[model samples]
Target: MNMPVLTSLRRRFAALAVLIASLPGAADAQADPAATFTALRAVDQRMATIAYRLTTANAPLCRGLVPVPGWAVHSLGQYDPAMRDQARTSFGFEAPIAVEAVVAGAPAARAGVVANDSILAVNGQPLRGAPGAKADSNARDAAQAVIARQPAAAALRVELVRGGARRTVAIAAPAGCPGSFEVLLGPGMDASADGSIVQIAVRFFERYTDDQVAVVVAHELAHNILRHRARLDAAKVSRGLLAEVGRNGRLFRQTETEADLLGMHLLRNAGYDPQLAVAFWRDHGGDVDGGLFRSRTHPSSKARAQAIADEIARIPAGSPRPYLPPLLATRDTPLQ
Candidate 1:
């Protein structure tokens, strides 16, 4: 049985508050709670679908794995106190926890879980939450913990309350690369991975096509898969102001290059054109270069596009699924 990554799973669901508040129209959330909730759910669904495709496709290459149910859950208590009543009215949250989104064709969707289904219990254990708790994720995390403990590919019984009636369904969870995919509600056009989750700003979705956005997702996922955060820590690389100069700068650039190459392979594995990595840099590189892609720490956009092109050329035609690239060999080695 494939073990679940509980820590990552917990972190993913714990960010519900920020996720809800960051979406567009959230500024007027109190005025039109339904619009804000719908916006959040829509972004959640898109991110989940993209992540599922990449994580499941590249599971074999990842050292950490989790059983992805293809559904995200949220708690009414996780919203701001002032928004609780609106959330209740819009989402019909009769309980603390409820299904937030289900990716199309994912395990949860096949098992019959739908959006806003109130989660009553999992594996016969009832979900519990503190009374009158506002902006808390304790109950939501508890529910996720229960599900993450189950063996991968095993049938997990989930009790749901829909339309005032309760029914149980068994979700056969599938093993996938462990990490939550989320869209941070904001106007910034940036993406980051904290080892446990991949969060992209909402502006990317508003501006770019899904295919172009996947290029960014694959790059961030490559960082997690390569363990770049832990490796940089192990090497004692400085992340402060000095990070953009001297040895610190060189090491950071190395990680960026590795992520670029490996990210292309990830894109290919997921049936996305690796060339889009180059396209993304060509099309939007200037937009981010002044911000996150500062030359001191990252290659120039023109240089980045060229680098991806070179990597794509290196991959032999019709090789195999999960095409193992050269940089992956150094993943466990120390960064120098």
Candidate 2:
């Protein structure tokens, strides 16, 4: 979870429009088009699963704040013809927003909303009012707009199609977390938190397995939980060369350490293997360039992996308990 200091150094030269960037392909010849589409579908399926697990498991910690439904969907148009056909063949219907995955025990899950369900309407309202021009945003915004408008602890009437049958299901929204998870377009296995939302890059989904992806995600989610970005600003940590020297370095390392520990618990609570944290760092830590062996900004990969392992050992056996983040010590506008 200790990001390379070199990446930080590079950003010092430019305006820090983005908060954090952490380090972390082959085409088949003449294969069945469906086979290729299946791989993409599998990736999306994993994203949905992890997003739901993390959001719902951490819901209680963010309770009293409004929370979005613990589920993910995508526009049918996002897929190409072959992929669309593959989806129709696999899920029975592909129209409007298609349910990719539903978190176990979340409001959507409790209402019997399962994967492959084509969402037709929300509260009897047709899927409309996409806020953005992009196809993906159009689909996502439409669904979120409905959820965002609901009163606290209000129920949602979702009409969807399963096995070619139309049905209406009622979901009671949890009074949980405030932010939602988003998958961003781009390359690299990077992710970030701006105190409000967790953005995972598409390349990450294309790069790591679901378990590995979960570890990285848990790390970013931990940032939001700890409200690290906001805290750093409140402390007025310098962002220039002074920060690179030691001022901001110390603060960042401190937050990174906290994020790693809380991230493991987040993973465990979400039913993921917290041990993967150790394994992931051990496997990829050396791949990153430019951090001191005993750097003030970040623990060396070896030390970090050890720290993660030690924390994992400290956890007692049983169901993982939620780790509630303290309310903001000082509220500030979230940075991008």
Candidate 3:
């Protein structure tokens, strides 16, 4: 449809969404009946904030080709935050991590991997053995090997679980040099013609702060696991949360939500405290561009936080944490 028709449709959805969320009384879900209305209004305000953050969070994670405004022109991955430091050495991997750049027009992009997707394990083998200063680069090398060994131009199947579903997708890659895979962490990121492979500019997960990096890596990993890039390609257009603003907005939001769900699973599977995903985003200090009644492509920051908490509650506690400090020994130890 044309511009006017699309605008009218979006307006219609906005109206319907309010009713569907039954949000007017959301304030009434307060601690007490007397404070119910007051609390509800607070909830409303917070929800509005969350909405803007959602869109901001999807920036670099979304298909790099989308022209949506970025939190920055480049979303570089650095261990700038304490959380990132904490996530390192926490995964208890017995091997070194291997990092790889995604090849443009290759299967990895089709798989939705950002520059930061931490290949903690390959074929169920951890990266502790890869060998390197960080030991993490081994995982990257291992991943390259996996790709190299695969039949060229063949459809490769990758498994990832998103939300409550395990999603699998096949990507036909250029054969021979898996080493040809190139990746950028921030603005350097690029997308392939078919939208399968992507070059990300950073690697936040490599920063290493236990649950913190787990959340970061898991989020990026989710993009590939959920086939978000492919989904974006399928969607001819989307406009941020106003998805009304651009043809690709709705697609952007949907891919983000899908990735969030899948990312949650990756974190859980990797043996990190899944709840930290929520905490990490809370501390992430996202951009809140939209004003009242404005929306984002991804779920509100509040929603992202809540969804993560919800997912964590459902995951059966998995293997024990591999790299945690001795709890009993350090419980009351002085902070050195």
Candidate 4:
């Protein structure tokens, strides 16, 4: 009996060592601050691009989907001077909005807008000021403000420079949801949706590919679309910490399953392989709880992986519907 106990103890210690190594800090050494910020911003840019693509692609299939100008723009040097200099050199012009990407079949693409085109002005208002990061932000804000004020299918004039040649083109805006996304610089695999905004962690972004990131973003967006956050707050499930934890855990586990389903639809609509969702969750799900134990707040990694597989099978490839299942929440158990 004593010998058996000693062997079991040794195996348990080894397992703990593996688990400890996988934790955020132990797994990867601390990253340089500048490098981390740069990486986060890249994720921010990509998320903005993907979110716009997914929402716009599915707009016609879903109701109340408003489309904005279908283009991706970004500014540089928000935190560091080196980034700004890099942007100027990369684009060969110091413009406020750098057209990083244009969605195919979108208004901008139809207008022959190409990547590396530096946006000079919108609606005849010459965009010029400080080339600082704030100026870059202001430029984007002005563009969005202009878009917000326009009617659906309205034509807007955009002045841009390609290969140092100035040209003005007209782009018609589409209707899409007013929701947007941002990235948070932090450790750990965390994401959330609060009605209108989807926040993704940089650590998570660094760990996954764009397709994997899409699954997470789509899931969070699903939460917002289903109004889970507001419903949870309204339920007032519990005031005590332990009580809230138990109630929320149970509720979120259910919502997690639903998000996995809806996220697949979003991914399909956006032209990303829905199968990647299954791969991502399966590979990383086990890491969530370390070993065999699964939390109430989320289904077991095995269960989640299987759920994604099931969902993928249910939704036919190349035919996606922007339909979300009705989420009916009881008084105590919120859908989220």
**In lDDT terms, which candidate is top?**
1
Flag regions of model 1 displaced more than 4 Å.
1-31, 131-138, 291-295
User: Total clashing residue pairs per candidate?
Assistant: 1, 0, 65, 6
Candidate order, lDDT descending: 1, 2, 4, 3
Model 1 TM: 0.87
> What tens digits encode model 4's per-residue C-alpha lDDT throughout 176-269?
6556565544334557777665766556655767777887887777666666667666755442344327766676666677767677777876
lDDT of 1 by residue, 215-286 (tens): 888888999999888898899987767888898989888888888889889999999988889988877877
Using Cα atoms with residue i matched to residue i, what is each candidate's TM-score against the true structure? 0.87, 0.67, 0.36, 0.65
TM accuracy, model 2: 0.67
lDDT of 2 at 124: 79
Candidate 2 ranges beyond 4 A from true positions: 1-37, 63-70, 76-96, 102-116, 124-126, 130-139, 148-155, 161-166, 172-176, 184-187, 202-208, 236-243, 288-297, 309-320, 323-336
lDDT per model vs. reference = 0.77, 0.62, 0.36, 0.59
Which 10 successive residues of model 1 have the least lDDT summed? 1-10
lDDT measured at residue 210 in model 3 versus the true structure, 0 to 100: 36
- Residue 138 Cα positional deviation in candidate 1, in Å, after optimal superposition: 4.2
All-Cα superposition RMSD per candidate? 4.9, 7.7, 22.5, 11.0
Give the poorly placed runs of model 3, Cα more than 4 Å off: 1-147, 151-210, 239-248, 285-295, 316-336
Residues 53-127 of candidate 3 have per-residue lDDT tens digits of 222233223222221110010011211222223223322122233111233333455567422234343334333
Model 1 score (lDDT)? 0.77
